[model samples]
Target: MERLLRIENVTQKFGGLTALNNVNMHVDKGEIVGIIGPNGSGKTTMFNIITGIYRPTEGQVLYQDEPITGMEPYLISRKGLARTFQNIRLFSRMTAFDNVVIGMHARTKTNMCDIVLHLPRKRREEKECEERAMELLKLVDLYDVRYELASSLSYGHQRRLEIARALATGAEILLLDEPAAGMNEQETDELLQIIRRIKELKKTVILIDHDMKFVMNICERLYVLNYGVLIADGTPEEISKNQDVIDAYLGEDDE
Candidate 1:
């Protein structure tokens, strides 16, 4: 399998505190990988470094073998990498369709002048953007509520809409942060199906979630972090039995 992303000796620090220390991991093309760790274990820090929200204090991030470390977040996004925050960050005032259309703006080619003049190119691109946004909405199973205000949707639908918006960015790799954070069992099951569909669409995904069942069920491989260090990397079955992982995150269950 081709390596789509590589984090080489990545480290992050804030003042005198080290958030990530010599972390190394890789994600293959078309694979759904999971990053699991307890809170403050540097999972989000790792995502920030990968997505260019924060430059690593040391080390590098590579996408398709090209170094992307220190690149601006928007540039990284335009390079086909996009992410959703742990907390919902939708355009609450906008309609679901409009929120997705905003994401399409990054790939849009129509210039300011074209839009100012209401040129034919602008009209054509606008039409295409709406079409694409609607297509993504359907892909995430939110087409029926496409015209509803994003703030009005249920928490589960809001999460799905956020994924649709991320898809609108034309991302080949999606970094989903706690996508199942507040979802109930039914919503989580629906999310699982959506993730499978995303995989079928040939998109690589890296997710951080506390839902062990959800993560373990969907991710082909898992990387475990503890106290800013990678403690284990393996399949779900292997991780489930790994002593270090069990000690750090999954406490001993009553026998």
Candidate 2:
């Protein structure tokens, strides 16, 4: 298994509080990893550090064996990493298709002049973007609502739309932040199918969800964080039986 991402002794600080304390993590090609913790346990903070939303105060992050720690968010995105926020952040007035189109804008080769003049190059790029976006939407089972206003969609579809938009960015690794929030059991079940398709698309995912079953079902490995430190890392079965993990977040009766 080739390592797609590696974090070595990462530490991040906000004032006197430590958000990540000498944390180390890694993911391999085509692997689905889960990070679980209580609130303020720094799960999102670790994602921020990996995606360049926050720079690590110590240690290093290597993606594809190259240092990506402290790099700009755009730079990280360009290197085949993208993330969805805890809260949906779509363009409210824009159609779902257009919102996804804008995400592809970062990776499109058409320059300002090409777009302004609507040159042949621009048309070619636009066609490709639309095709890819539609494909991603189909993968997430949201193609029928492509032209619907993002704000008009239900909370579930909106979250699926965000996943489509992130996929549009051509990211090989997706860091999903609480993707199943506010979802019912049925919606979460559908979400699991979408996630399965994402895996078939050959994208590695780091899932952060409140749903314990969702995490354990799809993730090959799990990492438990408590108070900005990693308390456990193991398979779902191992994590379930681990005393430290049970004490930290999953109570003894959780399994």
lDDT of each: 0.92, 0.89
- Which stretches of candidate 1 lie above 4 Å from their native place? 116-118, 250-255
- Give the TM-score of each candidate: 0.95, 0.95
**TM-score of structure candidate 1:** 0.95
TM-score of 2: 0.95
Highest lDDT scorer: 1
* Lowest summed lDDT window (length 10), candidate 1: 246-255
Q: Count clashes in each candidate, considering only residues at least 3 apart in sequence or on different chains.
A: 0, 0
The residue-by-residue lDDT of candidate 2 on 150-217, one tens digit each, is: 99999999999999889888999999999998898888889989988999888899988655678999
Over 4 Å off in model 2, which ranges? Answer: 115-118, 250-255
Candidate 1's clash total is 0
lDDT of 2 at 190: 90
